[model samples]
Target: MDFRRTSTALTREQKLAVVSVADVKAQERITNSYEDALIGQYIEAAYDYLAGPDGWLGRCCLLEETFEAYIPNPGGGFELPIRPVVDLSSITGFEVSDGAGGYDPVSAALYAKSVNEGFGYILHSGQSSWPISIGVDPRRYKVTFKAGFGAADDVPSPIKLGIIMLASHFYQNREATFSDNRITAVSRQIEFGLRNLCGRYRISRDHS
Candidate 1:
């Protein structure tokens, strides 16, 4: 996934600070353009993997996007998915369309005060009938929302540290992998370190 933040969470100076390398020429061994690019790549990858609709760990912010949810046709009625959504900061818009081509905006009065529980929402106004779309459309309901911690500063300390640690590890071991693509000790160490941070914001099995 493409990250909204274009640069690494940790700055070049910050990476150098982490390793205590002050000389510009010596630091170029790890802070060159190619290495800087790799560091940024790893930072985004870690952020994406940890702050998830899938994996769990980091905090994110200033994100806004639209998502679609398909209403399932059961013999009884429509059912929404109960899984914990990833990085769903807030649901700003909820609208539905009729199978034929008409659309209607769902009123907030029909549901609770917009509380997001377990990354999903449940209407509390006792209304069960939502907009429906028939035929082959998988997503009849559209939701626009934002996710993340709010800004880079708001990200948890552990997650930021994890990103720094992992990026530094990769930066130091440019040739950690072999021609056969074998993982190196440095890679394993960073991977192991990341595991320690993965559970920070994990969704529980019983989340509601």
Candidate 2:
């Protein structure tokens, strides 16, 4: 449905409509959902980087040895800083704990999540996984594919060329200037990566 475009000027109060707390929370959820999905993408990319041509699952444990701080989003939500575990050099004793405890799991988990989201930047050329073409300004393309997956309730990643075209906008912009395809593909990759991660999540396996 087309929203009516009103150019009429409104008072400051009218312009600044107060959003209810519920609405704010809902918006936060949506934003966080996207960010959470993005995190998955970073994880996949990092995992791929660590794994190379061979399967990624086997090398996940290496990250634990290099445990580091988690990096949060620019504003809020996540709260982990980026730091290699190697940089940490202040341990005085080496007692054996019941559980294989080394660096903080919570922080490491978050860091691993972020790296997964950074994968899109790595696989999106005209040759990697998808032969999807992207112009200098990819916002102009009309293809879509997901480099990762999000929550379990999340929808399936659209890998079809038709969906990719539609998502990228075979003809128009859905959200911003970034080709509709790019966003959709990016979203799909993130969702698929995370969704399929249950049995094969790199971080968990590595840490375990």
The candidate scoring highest on TM-score is 1
What is every candidate's alpha-carbon RMSD to the true fold?
7.3, 23.8
Q: What TM-score does each of the candidates earn?
A: 0.57, 0.17
Residue-level lDDT tens digits of model 1 in 15-124: 33322222222434553454445555555554455544444542222122233444432223221232223333455555666656655676665554233432545344
Look at candidate 2 and tell me the lDDT of residue 127: 25
lDDT for each residue of candidate 2 in 78-169, tens digit (9 for 90 to 100): 21211111211211111111122322212222211222322211112222222222333212111111222221122122211112222222
Q: Cα lDDT of model 1 overall?
A: 0.45
Candidate 2, 197: how far from true, in Å? 3.4
On a 0 to 100 scale, what is the lDDT of residue 36 in model 2?
Answer: 41
Measured by TM-score, how close is model 1 to the native structure? Answer: 0.57
Find the candidate with the highest lDDT and give its number: 1
